[model samples]
Target chain A: MDQHPTIDTRQTLETPEGTDLSLYPAGFWIRSLAYTLDWLLRIAVVVVAGIVLGASGMGQGLTLVIYFLMEWFYPVIFEVWRGGQTIGKKSLHIKVINDDGTPVTFAGSLIRNLLRVVDFLPGFYVTGIIASLCNRHFKRLGDLAAGTVVVYANSVAASPVLESVGSRPVPDGFNTDEQRFLLAFAQRSSTMSPARQAELAQVLAPAVAPGDPVLAIKQMANHIVGDRTQSAKGHLL
Target chain B: MNLEQLRIAIRPRRDWEAVDLGLRMAQQWWWPMLRVWLIITSPWLVAACVMPPEHQWLVSLCLWWCKPLFERPLLMILSQGVFGVELTTREVLRATPRLFLNQVFLSLTWRRFSFTRSMDLPVIQLEGLHGAERRDRLNVLHRIDSGPASWLTIIGVHVESFLMLACVALLGILIPEEVGAELWTWGFWGESRTGGALLILFAYIAMAVVGPLFVACGFSLYLNRRVKLEGWDIEIAFKRMAQKRGLPTVAILAIAALLQLTPPMLPSAQAQSEREAVKEEILAIKKGPDFHRMETQRVIKSTEKKEEEIDFDKGFWRALIEFLTGAGSLAAAVAGIAELLLWALVLLGIVLLILKYGSWLERFPQLLPHRRRREYRPQTLFGMEVTKESLPDDVSSAALALWQKGEQRPALALLYRASLTSLLTVGVALREGSTELECLRLAERLQQELGIPQTSIRYFSDLTRAWRRLAYGHQAPSDAEGTALCRDWAQYWPEVTRG
Candidate 1:
């Protein structure tokens, strides 16, 4: 088959402990969002702590410690204890992990969070952004130095129902993924613009049927996404 | 493909690809994106509608600040859309009731003003992980291949502001001069009540459109990052291959996945290489190539003893003696021969001067061909790309050979490079670093200044355009298209000697 090869952009990393970590490093946007969310919480803590600590006689000293802990140990504490979710990170669904896809160890978290100072640079994480942009995994200086990776926390369930109500006889030579792609193309076509539907259809037309295959592909799609109308198997014809 | 068929539904891709995907995905789920925006902004919309005109700026500011709140639902829509599923507005709203506390806790912070908030939405809003797990997951998800999402959010916000200003300005243009005079006054954004209201309205529109797009972009980037991390594309390919061959491919995937986790034996080698990659590829390209020019050939003369002065005197004297055949005529002929010999020596001196300093004398227009002569020995030019390493001989002959072999583009490129190389005489000082556009611009500027003929300039310009169109624009030229251009090659470059 003259296959349109599926290009995998995953960065496969090996661990010191010999675990293969396939990770897609989030870019500036995702990391920045998590940082923003975390920063917001940090500010709230500072405000509350300032009031509470200012009331005490040992105010300034206690405040500095709180600031240091929140700034440095906050991410580390959350990542080590909560399996990588901070209050901010949980909201966004991103997590910290070792470069090899293992749980972020305490040492790894400490190194990464500690190196955040370098990532911070003279001003607004400028060096970090540049570092992230330069690398394929979008690692900031901290992540690079620490050998940590940021990845999307996958959902456990994969049972989301597609449109298919009953079995449709897929062609013999076709694989499960192709069949799934064909079904997806078919299901998506109607909901999509006519031109987009055709475009998607046209791409997979040869896989289903090579010559004047548009109608045949559509029929196959119709077969796969069984009729929704109750009682009768509407694919009678 | 047309706008309707922009791109594929799902795949692991880069930042630009994510941005592009967001825009394209919006085409299919534009309804959901718009609906989510409309629903979230309804309070503001109604407030703006019902509030007094004077107080609208406050409403606008509030709406702008609360964009984070509105973005949550749309983020859901976009996240689902990334997986080829569009979430209904009702479904999104319903799921959010239980997650209200999480959303509120996430929203409250000074970081709301921070630009990086755009990318962070996915971790907090979508994932179920908490504490250390969440942090670890964030570590995996946060290092997005697409730089920082803050750029898009910030740029999106700025673009929205610009769009608002332009729209308000356009609206301001419509009013009659008498009523609109104050509208055109400086600081109208804050000054006049009417202008302020217009600004607010446009700002609202900007928010309505850009807010959804902002979420969509973030969501797409987030999804792409995860897809890349999980090796979804590789898994899909393997799964497909397995189904085709009826082999146990899932186990192979496990092994392949396991291999990646195994620690690299040569970590220092990787680190060393990383330490060495100081200058990025883009910077090197921008620095461009160095220029080198060959010196023109100097005319050399040979002095030999065979150049004895008696040669001309003997022939003339013998001829005079044979033809005239008298004492008085012979004496006259000898005197005439001496005078002729003196004139001949002077003529020889003049010819030697012209031959020895021909390049200097050719500077004068009427004395010789007004040519800019140079040796055809350019080793490299045009970003150091047009090298004659493959063709070691004259350019035209090499080009002809290439053309015969059906190498149309290379042949044209070679011809153009040679012309530019020849133009080095007129101080074209083109360096290896000079880009194609730079070369064309230099050639264009020099055309009139160097007094190159218009038709010849057009030929070079056509060749440049054709070469560029083929190389960069990905368009190939028609066959036998430049036959006339080829025949008039001499006219095109009358200055330089033929290569």
Candidate 2:
């Protein structure tokens, strides 16, 4: 009943300029970390600005303006100008892009950051956290309004695969995963206790063979490898 | 194809790989992951700080109970990230109000107490399945725990406890010696509820750091399972490969057509009987009361399911109304009543006919065409020609000739591939994409089982080493070394056909 079932998370988008770009969104914590980093940096900058503009009424007014500009417009200015990254976003290797994986436009940047107030409700960005958590793209209210997504700056490493020796046909009713499990079970069971082996083999017993499942699995393992070596056998090479 | 050129691979991964991928996922998404962890647990953090040590755990217990509240949002965040989608904070929060009822129901289960709950979170919060369908989906998803998710969750909880204790003890150091002594003592926690608050606060911090990882691991395992079950990875891999090759339509199109031309693995009679037997078994199960109940529940919310049952009070009135309205009208207008009744009966008969033959009727068009197997067949493997007849009859001598001619690598590959073929015939279930080490290990284990001579094992081991060296290290074997392997090949596969 999911209005949108997982339909696969690999998103493909045609950029405004008409090239296809694919991206994986950054997770909540990674983006939060970047945001936290940015927050700290901004706080430090504000503190320095406060000290520099020390107690005079004129200076106090100037500091307020500086703080307002920095607080409200920091992310917007940097995101639009610095290739969709603020200082924090850049450090964490995440960037803001349109929903279609295109570079963020100035308008997209402005709207998303502007909606930050709503996302920050009930304090500590809780509303925003909730929004990002429940959202498909981890977008806060701002990003949703602007139709932008935040994606990992770099590509994910390809899944590591066991080295391919060659194409070998698996037996009937068994898939590649079963083949992997069978092989792993067989290899690991060599050093396992008999009781443990029996316990584990019991689960696989019905599917593999009738009796002495462990032995059958082992025999199959031996058979699959075509091991001709015996404790005592002389064969022509 | 070489590793670099292979655009993408879609397949079920080993357990370690799955977990490693979880860690990889965490690294990819550390920020919002960390922030949300802190944000959700912040209340518990406050409770621990303000309340005494004794009362602090109550707060934790509460947090633990309401874990699903915290879990759903986090899962959405991670799942979206997995798919390369991003949402801002409020956007994530925006859906929470709407899903409040679902969260309450999903979070109520005892399953939440264990780490295994992490695996189930996505189904509960995301899939939008209810009642029986959710149960069935759970059955399919949780068939295997993959071991790590549950074990890690327990370990994380235990570690959090210890870390909490350590923080409490550290707090003890800041107090006066007498108070400090009291603080560190076992009864000190029991003496005051407020005393433990500090301890709980620190524990909350530790939990934030550690909790998501276990949850992420569970989530990762869940993701991996779905990937395997649904072939998501394969679909993505194929898409990537097609894109990289810039032959999106042609290559896959050709292969898809090729698949259509292949044959089914089983004979028609045997396959048909097997299919029928399976169908019968399914029918028998489906006919049972349990199956009917689950089926009904699949599409309905658990809450509304009971409403569908007959209401005894209303049932009588409805029956009375039906009986009273029909007969009196019939008496006044017999002809009209008879004509209406006849039409109703005809429509009922037509409805019954369609229901009875619905499945076959839907399938009628598909049955007209001659069918073929649609399994994907590998064309080239191990950068070598692969065919039903590619394996040599005499592996050793063939390799020996190649070695003499200074083509040592292909010679070794020939011997290795031959050994693999021999292994497959004997029932070693190696796949095409397995690495050399995996092959070596499998062969080593099976070599002992087959009881090949001790000298042959040693020699086979040496040849394996040589291949591993040449393939990965790019170091060629010396003349003497090459001749020695040439000597050993005949020993492992004694029945090698003479070239």
Candidate 3:
């Protein structure tokens, strides 16, 4: 087998390879709250209905019917109409996402909610609790069945700023195109290593420096990129 | 459009100094949590004591006629107070009883009023503290900025509270009929009514208690959800928040509501007597004097006095026994004993055979002329003379060659054939219908005809065993063992081949 230097590059890409999917345990309190809220609503509906209609067999039957309806439609109607949330979920600042991290579809929502019975397990969510404890994503039976993920609604970090060419002075020897190239380099400086930055700067030095090479290179980078003072502070070229 | 410009543009324009000043002011009022709770609860405490009987009735009547208006303020006060107080079991019990009463009243009054119509009113405002700002702060405060009480939560709490309180009242009402009237009178209004009226009243109190308890439960659930999602417990831990805040407020509101509602819910004399009888029966279990009870009391007294002495000697002996006789130690001992016995038996057998056979073997030196008197000069069947220094080449190289080529079956066949051929060449006689065992017997005959040393003949038999294993054993021998066997066989082969 021939040893190839490029093999290291391929290895680099594969070595730290992350699966696009990631699972996070749903916090204990959130699930507990959701469950408590679910029970509370179900019980409230039954009791109030029983009381109002009078605690006869008919009243009990009506309460059960109402409960069944609420159970079936509550999550579906609310999640679809209100950007993926039931009242309990909305309060928790959590939303159900698809396996690929997209908004949950109607079908996905239905599948997850419909599996509530299975998630409920022996009684009071014993199976769901065990599953959540064992799994990384804190997925209950419902989440697993539906291939859904519950995540913080706005947890993604904001992107950083990029420097522009129009804000700085051009180097003495560099032409217009070289100035533009330096700006692009500076814009990506934060992500690049110091060594890489120096290497790229050296590559551009000939075009940039006509006299007093270091000074000329510095001036050209400053001219192309804004915030000359910060550049002078050794953050980047 | 770049990040820096966007950041600058989006940065708040408010004066930091003013905001800081406001925060400083707020910080000054950061009283102890207990103080906050006391302040919130002061009004209810005062109401409970100072409010005249007439005023109490009026408030209860008002609650019945206009439940939402009365419920909201009462709940707000109680919940806020409970949230501030450090929770304790006593507080829970105190709160529970009141909630029980309130739930019953709420249930009874709910029939006369239209709950849906009240629900439609602007119970929750969408602006100010109750609005977007309040929502935002609450999100940050409770860690539930996004999730709010859904209609499901509200409805659920109400129903659950109602049912739970009803169950409790039903339990309370199940006391023997004799004491029922007295208990009802003691807890509420003294008037008696029919059995049906009493049942209705009890149900009413259950409803009252259920409502606030449900609300409290819903709030706790909401808080729990936030904690789960955001690790709100970290904040609670940091802030030294107490669990009492969660449970007590609900209990207080529930209890207060129940108390307010209980005045009208007690049963008539007959029903009261039946309920009293049940209560007596339950209490009787604890009240009776028995040997078990005396023993329990004695144990309790002894424990409380700290008079019992530790039996250290007994414990030490048990520990020592456990250490020596544990499963691991016992297994290790068994294995060590078995290994020692096995080696000793093998050594004994070798010594006994050498002593018993040596003299007899010496007498037949001429019959076995290969054996020397001075030292045992082992020899092979071929004309090649053998000594300890010189060994006959006995193994078939052809068999090894076939094995090296990965033809294990063929190699084994070659070995068997070579052994048979060697035996035949040496004038060994065998029956025509003989099996492999018969071939071994023929090899033994050839060994006797050739006057081969017993050790040399034994080596041949061992080789046969190895070949049989290689050909017919289900699992092949381990690599190291097989390699060692091959090396030993190769060393012995030169001597066997010469023989």
Q: What is the lDDT of residue B361 in candidate 2?
A: 49
Candidate 2 — which residues are off by over 4 angstroms?
Answer: A1-237, B1-11, B44-57, B98-100, B172-181, B244-499
| Per-residue lDDT of model 1, residues A1-237, tens digit only | 212221223567786878776665555555666788899899889866654443333554666788989988999999999978887777766688888788899988999999988876534565575576455566888888788877766542232333433323557776566666555444434334455344434444445544434444545555655643421342442
Tens digits of per-residue lDDT for model 2, B12-101: 554434544454555456677766555545555555544554566777778766766765666656665544455444444444444445
Per-residue error for A158 in candidate 1, Å, reads 31
Question: What would the per-residue lDDT of candidate 1 be over residues B1-499, giving only the tens digit for each residue?
Answer: 0111112434546565465455444444667777656655566655664567677767887887777877776766655544334455555655544444554654656657756566666667776445677667666676645564767877676557655665655556575666534454433545444455556667776677667667777766776775555434433543454445655333333213322332222324344443343233223323321112312222222234224435766888898655433246654565455456556777999999989996555433234333433322235665443433433356656666677787777777777766775566555545445677776777778777777667776887787787888788878677666544444555566555433
TM-score of each: 0.36, 0.33, 0.24
Q: What is the lDDT of residue B224 in candidate 3?
A: 32
Q: What is the TM-score of chain B alone in each candidate?
A: 0.46, 0.43, 0.22
**Per-residue lDDT of candidate 3, residues B298-414 (tens digit):** 111234323222355567878865653334665456545545655677799999997999666544444444424223322432222223233224444555555666666655554
Backbone collisions counted per model: 68, 70, 77
Q: Candidate 3 residues A31-53, lDDT tens each? A: 55666776687778765654443
Q: For residue B278, what is the lDDT in candidate 2?
A: 44
